[model samples]
Target: MSTPFDLAATDELLSTTRAVRKRLDLERPVDVEVLLECIDLAQQAPTGGNRQGWRFVVVTDAEQRQLIADTYRRVSQSYFASRAATPTDDQTGRVRSSSDYLRDNLERVPAMVIPCQQGRPESLPLAAMASYFGSIIPATWSMMLALRARGLGSVYTTLHLVDDGEQVVAEALGIPDGWTQTALIPVAYTIGTDFKPAKRPPVTQIVGVDGW
Candidate 1:
């Protein structure tokens, strides 16, 4: 059967949405309307039990952005110190380079997106933990895809959550007590939207037929 949609464009959008960092245009102002539109699209993503618990806190204020950036920087020092000592393959090396660049210039990025869920996964049972976070992660990814489609770029960052940083950021942002942050995303317009699909190992090596 033939499908009505443009599969090539769909695949292109899916494949080319890179974890953009260094190429992010830090100086460009991301319009609030566009960001909201993307989130509106994201809200259509399926949620666990249809709780619809996703919430996004968009930080565009200079002082708040700096504070969030500072918190991230403080948490990353030891991480980078250890990462520097570890050996990396070609792909890992590029990621590390971009991560370092983002870390240094995080404050200058125009908007920071903090995605939150309704409840804390840490205290939930294993199954519930999965269910709790399963609700928001897809919507977050959808948000990224929508951003890419609109000539914007973002990177998912959980580095700050390593050292009570989430609590600090929540306090800084005045987030309510019950909600838990899932990730920190830096959002900006890309310097260019010419991202190509990333290289990966052949599917045959990773995929199994009916069973592994």
Candidate 2:
């Protein structure tokens, strides 16, 4: 155990956990135990009613990955097709183009992780939506952080839910009926660990005082 300093490393990890895409090393195989460890940590995240109803579906089979990627592409293409581009800013233009590339090549990724929440019988009150999603997103971030520390990279994408047919894809993957598909994460060992934080607006700009 090389324990000279720990919290510093953790603070660094949280700050540097990047949403890696092209850097994901598709050729290397990821160990199951590593992913499980991350999942275990994810479970500790809060859930609605402390119900802990989230389910994770992992797809590693070659054929299954193909189907999933194909579905994602179909839906993503349709979604992208509908959007109009305004070259108003460099970042916006770059993001739109990058998304197109990711959608077109998603099939090449090695693994897919789908995070689902247990379906509630009735629509939740609008006021509770924040807390409801809050429970699952933290755990998801935890998983990504764990993966980054272990030399892996993943991107959270939901466009895969479009014409790609999430329901059919779910059935093909044997995901039980009620596990709602909240998001998908493609996993792979990253080629490099030298990721930097993304460019973004200052936190103060978005954060509001107690009352808006």
Candidate 3:
């Protein structure tokens, strides 16, 4: 069967959509309309049972951005600190350094995207747990791909979900009761559109044929 889409272009876009951090352009402002358009495209991604339970909070207000950044840093400081203490390979060490850079400059990024779901899943039954979160995560990744196609950068950060940090962020954003915050994504125009595919272990090492 012949596919109508351009395979090369699709492959390039999928492979190059990276978790951008230090390369995010902090000085420029992100137009909310563009983000909305991306979200529109993101909403098309398939959801488990088509439950469609995703919600997004876009933070562009400086004070609100600062508040979220502070909450994130309060949790991330200990996380990155512990990672820094342990020895790591060159690639891992670079990631640690870039993570620290992102933590320091998270407030400056023009937009903060918080993805949410309809309800708490922590104590739910196994199937319920899978369905609830399964509905939103793909949409979030779709949003990232949409952003990348538009020359924007974003990093998915969940450090702030630790302990009471999520509650603090929800209060700051005025997120109503019963919604569960999934992740905070920092977004902005990228410094350049030259991202390459990241290194990974060979497929044979990571996959199994029909069984683990």
Candidate 4:
């Protein structure tokens, strides 16, 4: 169902749910209903064969989050070291700033949401791959969209993949063995909402004719 909100506000929210890091208020707590409401919205996204192969693993305990946070930091340091090596031009500079913000504050964010797919096939036909990803990616985006609406912010990050510690983290959180952790999202309230749209090239520049 559509929100009972003005078009302009809807458009603004659609355009501006940025991957907030430094601006995420680590000290503030996000309520349970807000998270559940977002997940409910996420359930509406299209899934292949209506199989709906996605699962979300949310982490809230301090000890578990601490372990996950340490793993995140270990990988984040590598990411930022390379980030630091990049040329400090306008675009890279912005990247560097965001990287710094995330590196410094990833641990403190109030919640961690890990969106996973139901299965991990060793190999698949190209068409199968398309269908498989089609199932979960939309739900993930819907989750992000939901987050934007409820005065919360998040970033799609996968640095934890470097550790392959999902089983350990899963054990810590009591998540069953079959589910794989695809991406880790740190959810929290933003300090403010005055975000600007990211700069990108015009779509026409990348669009192709029938013949490439």
Candidate 5:
């Protein structure tokens, strides 16, 4: 079978698109046009019923970024404390360390993107809630892939959306009611683009053939 695209490059892009944290170059500025281009590409992702309701609120202002970062740090304190009380594997511990670093330096990142959906999922049925989130998550992932392809690095964090943190951020960003902020992504150029695939279990261990 003849493939129209370069499989090696395509596979490399997919495999190496990592959840960047400590390696994010905080001093480098990501261009607004590049972000817009990524969002444009992200919009091509599939949406429920073809209702594309994704809204990306990008925060580049220092003041706003600080406010959001503060909220994230405050909310993360309890989470970090909880994790500290429990035992974790080496990989999880490393992830927590990088998450701590990111929490401390989030405000310094070049840009923060809050991917949002148009509707609220509160009190909805499980299926409805899944449908609501299903619409936006794919687009957000697409945006991350696009960012990685452009030499930009990002990690999706949801700490700020905990409890009252969402309302506080909504007020800060002037995001109106009914819009659910899915995840907060810090965007910046990477120190280098030599990312490799992370370790994972074989497909046989994780995948279920028709049934678990």
Candidate 6:
């Protein structure tokens, strides 16, 4: 039997869709239509009860991007300070460096996307919270995959949504109440598209049979 899709290409796409940072081409401009196309594809993802309440707030205005970037940096300062004070392995250190770079250059990215859902999960039960997030996460990931397929790179960052930062960004972006922002994704073309699959533990080491 043959596969319905190109297995090799599918595997490559799945494996190589990395969380890009630092390598984002800041000088290149990304078309708004491309983002709209990716969002259209992402809308195909399943939503709770098919409500499809996901909303994407894209920031391309210089002032708005600057505000978001400033908010993110202000929130990340303490985090990066703590990480700098602690000991970390080489891989963790490298990740921190790249994240810092992204934090510093966030405003310069071609675009910023805030993936939002219609309901607030503030005091929802565990299951309800899961359902709430489950609705948006898949769509956001689909958008990321779509971005990768179209030669764009994006990194999912949530630092700006911490504590009062979410409200600050919301007010800045004029997002009405009752909606929760899931993540801030900075989108741009990649400097090069030669990303390789990251190293990971063997599947057997992480997977449980029927129970953990």
For candidate 6, lDDT tens digit of each residue in 119-196? Answer: 899899998888899999999999999999999999888999876889999999999999999999999999999889
Question: In terms of TM-score, which candidate is stronger, 2 or 6?
Answer: 6
Quickly count the clashes in candidate 5: 0
Regions of model 3 farther than 4 Å from truth: none
Using lDDT as the yardstick, the better of models 5 and 6 is 5
Candidate 3, TM-score vs. the true structure?
Answer: 0.96
| Range of the 10 consecutive residues with the lowest summed lDDT in candidate 4 | 161-170
lDDT of 1 by residue, 1-212 (tens): 59998999999999899999999998899898998999999999999889998789999999999998899999878999999999999999999999999999999999989999887777789889888888999999999999999999999999988788999999999999989999999999999789999998899999999999
Give residue 98's lDDT in candidate 5 (0 to 100): 94
lDDT of 2 at 159: 76
Which portions of model 2 miss their true places by more than 4 Å? 1-7, 120-122
Residue-by-residue lDDT tens digits, candidate 3, 75-123: 6667776777898898887788888888898889999899998888889
Candidate 3 CA-lDDT value: 0.90
lDDT of each: 0.92, 0.78, 0.90, 0.79, 0.92, 0.92
State the lDDT at 74 in candidate 5: 83
Tens-digit lDDT string for candidate 2 (132-168):
6777788888888888888888888887676537787
RMSD of each: 1.0, 3.2, 1.2, 2.9, 0.9, 1.0
Question: Candidate 3 — worst ten consecutive residues by lDDT sum?
Answer: 75-84
Q: Could you tell me which residue pairs clash in candidate 5?
A: none
lDDT (tens digit, per residue) of candidate 5 on 23-58: 999998888999999999999999878999888999
Q: Clash totals for all models, in order?
A: 0, 0, 0, 0, 0, 0
lDDT of 1 at 73: 93
Regions of model 4 farther than 4 Å from truth = 1-6, 209-211
